[model samples]
Target: MTGRAATRRPGLARVGATLARAWRAVSWYVKEVVGENDYEHYVAHLRRHHPEARPVSRREFERAKLDRMASDPGARCC
Candidate 1:
């Protein structure tokens, strides 16, 4: 292969790596914004602050969070 062809591959590889990193960051941001990370955080909190306590499952955690938010009027933006 020619010298130019060899160099072209490295450039394409760098572009692909950059795109992968960017997509991962975007995916993480979307999950955070949509509260998909809440269960992970809750688990961590329980482990750190209340190791003896049993953490609820994801479905129950979400259901309780929604119930609390609905009952608390101040939890809304508008």
Candidate 2:
């Protein structure tokens, strides 16, 4: 490869684009697996079913979720 062939850069651009897409897919999968999008779903649900209600912050949502899980006093803790 020489001159025009060696100077071609589309291959590098394609590799970078592929890597960016792969990173997005992997991050989305991890977030879904770990419930990272739960807050967004909760807000959507509130808007649909309880439009008059206020949506809680992510911190509050997580705290309430943990509290609910802990309320099963006789259940095994994870």
Q: Considering every candidate listed, which one attains the maximal lDDT?
A: 1
Kindly report which residue pairs in candidate 2 clash with one another.
none
lDDT per residue (tens digit) for residues 1-78 in model 2 = 577776677887889999999999999999988878889999999999999999999999999978976887565556
> Residue 62's C-alpha lDDT in candidate 2?
94
RMSD (CA, Å), each prediction: 1.7, 3.2
Q: Give the Cα RMSD of candidate 2.
A: 3.2
How much lDDT does each candidate structure score? Answer: 0.95, 0.88
Candidate 2: deviation at residue 16, Å?
Answer: 0.7
Q: How does candidate 1 score on lDDT?
A: 0.95
What residue runs in model 2 are displaced by over 4 Å at the alpha carbon? Answer: 1-7, 72-78
